[model samples]
Target: MLQDSFGRRFYYLRLSVTDVCNFRCSYCLPDGYQGKPDEAFLSASELEAAVRGFAQMGTQKIRLTGGEPGLRSDLPEIIYRLNRIDGINNIAVTTNGYKLPQRIQHWADAGLNHLNVSIDSLDSSTFHEITGHDRLAEVLEGLAKARELGLTVKVNAVLMKGVNDDLAAVLTWLKQTPVTLRFIEVMETSDQAVFFRQYHVRGDDIRQSLLSQGWQPVLRDVAAGPAQEFWHPDYAGRIGLIMPYSQDFCATCNRLRISSLGKLHLCLFAEQGIDIRPYLQTGVPTSELVQAVSEYVQGKKATHALQSHNSGAMANLSQIGG
Candidate 1:
């Protein structure tokens, strides 16, 4: 087993398949940002090899993330390769949910068991305003398609103060589906911090807003990630709040992220990551790669200063595997 500076075990890996996205969400990629990477990101084979090496190091959970993972054509093949690894216990993907309806069944067949869809608002006009795209109805349709394919679905809503603070509308819309909804507090990722001050919503504020609407917390004793979970007494599914800004979960963060260009990020707010593509290209032994990953993990920070410091110059969420 590998451990970080904060005594957090490394078991989960978030892999970014590409840095290209169809939508330019306000919080993620602000409007009119034209900076795109040079090459077509990692090929399916390169990503598969990386996952295999990480899995050999006791990383059992693999989450495919991206500017939008569905934008990649060979995503299923990458998932299939990861699923075939010996130690991989779970294979999941975090998408904008724009293309899920057409590919949900294909993804399920490729061994993807769980999905987290980013849906900031329930209103179509509000969603279009937030995402810079008019695919709100398509996202809802994708959520339904995931459920139909028997995939465990989670809705990730980045809670902003005046943007989509309508918890009532969000909850009401979620009640109509079986997807578990999670409200994410905005973080201080590089480009995000530019607009962070205006849209920042603390996790405590989110909990209070929901409580005011008669939502009760449901406690569970289970392994943890970035989300602090709760449940609505009357709703069919649970509510989770991932408060990376207000309350840090670095002490229990078991995951590491890999950028689309094959860099390993120890923390979300970290400025730089160790490049592993050289090791991959050289056909290094698995043990050597594991040792490299161990060294990177050992350098993980105890906590992020997103609330107190400025991290607006760091890599965007699309480039750094959200």
Candidate 2:
């Protein structure tokens, strides 16, 4: 198993297939995506090699992430190939739902089991203002289509002051929508300090309010991500809160990340990515790749220093597929 120095066993891997996103969310990519001419992202073959190595090291859950994973035309192929890997049991995708309604069927046919779509607001105008896109209706249709196909779907909303801070609509939606609604606390990045200060909201406040309203805390699975999920008997859906700023938040860290360039990120706020592309190249033994990754895992810190206002080398969430 991929065990860190702190004895945290990693069973999940967040793999970034691309860094280019179409959405210009106000908080992230506010100025829009700017990529250089030679953005050497990992190819499908390279991704398979890298994932195969992780699978050999006991990684079972793979979450395909990107600035917008939908932009990759070969996403279904990637999922299909990754599904054939020996130890991988589950494949999920985190997307902005840009072309999801059109492309979800292909992904579902390729063995996709879970999906996480970013929907900042239920209100169309507010959603357009936040995401710089007026495709809320299309995204919602995609969600319905995904549910129809029997894929476990989750919607994520970034909690921001004066913006999506009001969860009344979300709670109401959850009363009918049979999907998990995850509210993520806005995180501070190297370049997002000003925005973070002006909009960051406390996830704990929402947690307290939910508890008071009869939402029961659900025990986290060993391989689950950072979301603290809650369920209510009166509602058809569950609520999840991702509070990076909370104390002891990293105590149950069970996942690692790989950037689009085939670099390993020990933590989302890690100072730098460890390049593992060299071992992922053709002809390299899987054992050698696993050894290199295992050595790098030993360097993971016990916790991130986000509480002290240090986001390490993270300029934005897109860089590491947050």
Candidate 3:
């Protein structure tokens, strides 16, 4: 495994294969913004090469991300190819779940049994307000179908301050479904200062609400990523809180990011990344690719920049993958 300057070993990779998304989420992308042109997307062949290279260098798990990864017609092929790559133990996808009904079967056939769906709100009207679409029913349908297919599904939310922080309804959904649920604190994204100021909920508030319900904290595994997990005796699934803003988890960060356009981000809040597209497209030797990635990892900082100073490096979350 490649260890950074701070001794953080990077083992998980969030790979972006496309920048386009079907939804215009206010938090993820600006209003009325379109994705880059087709010429900018990563080719299937190039994506495959990069995955193999990452796996060889020590990436055991990969989560395919996008503005909405399901928008790509060839997503199944890409997943299947990665599943067959040696040293890659787990292959998953993070999506909005709008296209799950139409495209989920293909993904399952490709050996992708893990999925993370974005469920911003349980109220249909609140969902519409947050995501700019009345697709909460669709997301729920996708979750139900996922349970039926025996796929391990995890629903995530940004926990927007007063807009959709309804833990009661969310807890009810958890009781009904066999899927795990996680709530992430809003991060400092580029260009969404007003939204953060108006809607950013603190980590302490979310915890207090959950504790008030008498949920018991559960011990999380070392490889559990950034979430602090919890459980209730009555629910079939678990609850996780990822507090990026309230408390940082950079000391134990074990992930790397590869943007669809070919940039390798050492940290999510980084100002820039190394473009590996040139090496991937040129049929470079595995040794050469591995060496380049190693050198880049050595330069990885101890932690990402502060959100307050991140305004200068602010970028659309979609650009670096979710």
Q: Residue-wise lDDT of candidate 1 within 105-218, one digit each (tens)?
A: 889999998899988888889989989889888888888888888888888888888888777776676576656788887776666656777888788887787788787765
Evaluation by TM-score, superior candidate among 2 and 3: 2
Candidate 1 ranges with C-alpha deviation above 4 Å: 37-40, 209-224, 312-315
Q: Among all windows of ten consecutive residues in candidate 2, which has the lowest summed lDDT?
A: 31-40
The order by descending TM-score is 2, 3, 1
Candidate 2 local lDDT, 1-322, one digit each (tens): 8899889999999999998888999888898888752498899989999899999888999999998889888999999999999989889999999988999999999999999999999999999999999999999999999999999999999989999888889989999999998999999998799999999999999999999999999998766889999999999999999999898999999999999998899999988899999988889998999999999999999999998899999998888689
Question: Could you give candidate 3's per-residue lDDT for residues 69-140 as a string of tens digits?
Answer: 888889999999889999887888998888678778889898897899998888888788778888888888
Question: Lowest lDDT 10-mer window, candidate 1?
Answer: 217-226
Q: Score residue 118 of candidate 1 by CA lDDT.
A: 88
- Comparison by lDDT, 1 against 2, better one: 2
lDDT, residue 140, model 2: 98
Point out where model 2 deviates above 4 Å: none
Say which prediction, candidate 1 or candidate 3, comes out ahead on TM-score.
3
Top candidate by TM-score: 2
Ranking by lDDT: 2, 3, 1
